[model samples]
Target: MTKLLLGRYLPGDSWVHRLDPRTKLMASFYYIGIIFLANNWQSYLLMFVATMVMVALSKIKLGFFLRGVRPMIWLILFTVALQIFFTKGGTVYWSWGWLAITQYGLTNGAFIFMRFVLIIFVSTLLTLTTQPLSLADAVESLLKPLRRIGVPVTELALVLQIALRFVPTLMDQTTKIMNAQRARGVDFGSGNLFQQMKAVVPLLIPLFVDSFGIAEDLATAMDARGYQGGDGRTKFRILQYHQPDIVAGLAMVLLTVGLVFLRA
Candidate 1:
């Protein structure tokens, strides 16, 4: 759980870290969309290279991004395996009762694997580089135009920010609770499926209790500090696009255009 890096922010002054949060947020979305445009190995290779270059610019070690992928490794492998075994087309290379590995299956499985890694890597980069507050600001800014339609964008953004902030805290709390339960002879790891679930009840009860207590304390603190919703609130720091943001946008455009021409 501690290895979960999706919602946690790592402070840095690297090029990727210095961009406006809004830019990073939009770029991540753009990359995800363009990634699907890649159909051939050449297109995927180009995307892979572009993604790695972004990682390099972030200046965070590749290992941290990889660690983010580790938690999803099972999921990635399962999806890839499904594609490899279930997808039918092209030359059949091997066969078992109802499953067969074919050229198309192998190709599709590789593509799926690359897609999973690239998406996860880009998303992890966004969260690792952008502060929760900045992300909320970006969200709120992007959604601001919807306010005329009566959408509560401010409240929604605040909720998102709080959720992101709480993920790490909750993970740590869960870890501590697990250790305490272990000390009390509650074996979380040893058991059949049903038995494991039964063992988890004790762990969950305390976690829920603690979570509520934490929420109550936060509410009290917010009330004491007079955080009466986002009405009339002004940001201490404003988001502004710079030269790097423009360059980054241009690079994305080029990548998108390249994928269109290169994809089969």
Candidate 2:
């Protein structure tokens, strides 16, 4: 269960792992921008090549990336079907009673599907290399300026960190509950849409109850520690922007500019 939502965090001393979390976060944004900027096959090919290069640098196994993508298979298929059957403009490929499959639809569907896949894979690469703690720290640091506006940066960071940490735990709990239901002669897979929805109720109830219980326990623990929300907290390790981070950021800027120019 922990294995389900936590994704594959492959431990390696690769260049991606050594990159600053801020750099990776910004790069992810730039990468997504480029993905959306893509118009034709040429831009898509360039984006794919760039994504592949990032994956290669991450040094995570291809299996890990595929595993991350498995959950989105249904979504990709749904988008493809939606685009192919609904989009209109180009030559008609086929037509049914009230549905039309046009050449434009096919092209649009393929492009959207590939775009989604590339976005998912590239984002997964960022998470695979960057530690959760590091991500939280980077986010907190990035949002520090918001403190001037009376925003609680530390509390926000803490919430994000706890959410990330518990994601795997909650997934494990859900899997356990699902298996327990299955063992009790409950067929979750083999059912109509309504039946499947009904079957999930039992699973969801237990999951929600357990989640509340865990939240309560966490609150109590925090209370026992005299925890105050971001009053005057001091970090054990402060984040420093290194030269590599600056270089990476500049590269991302260039990538964004290049992609924008290509689109133009």
C-alpha lDDT of all candidate models, in order = 0.92, 0.84
Task: Report the lDDT tens digits of candidate 2 across residue range 1-264.
Answer: 454445456678988888888788878977887688887777777777778878898888878778778989999999899999999888997999768999989988989988988988988998899877888888898889999999999898989989998887888798899999999977886679999988999999999999999999999999899887787878886777788788778866776676666663
Per-residue C-alpha lDDT of model 1 across residues 62-147, encoded as one tens digit per residue: 88899889989999999999999999999999999999999999999999999999999999999999987888889899889999
Q: Which predicted model would earn the best lDDT?
A: 1
Runs of candidate 1 with Cα error greater than 4 angstroms are: 1-7, 160-228
lDDT score at residue 199, model 2, on the 0-100 scale? 91
Residue 201, candidate 2: how far off, in angstroms? 11
TM-score of each: 0.78, 0.75
RMSD, candidate 2, Å: 4.5
The alpha-carbon lDDT assigned to residue 79 of candidate 1 equals 100
Clashing pairs in 2: none
Q: Model 1 shows how many backbone clashes? A: 0
Best by TM-score: 1
Total backbone collisions, model 2:
0
The positional error of residue 131 in candidate 2, measured at the CA in angstroms, is 1.5
Q: Which ten residues in a row have the lowest lDDT in candidate 2?
A: 1-10
lDDT of 2 at 237: 60
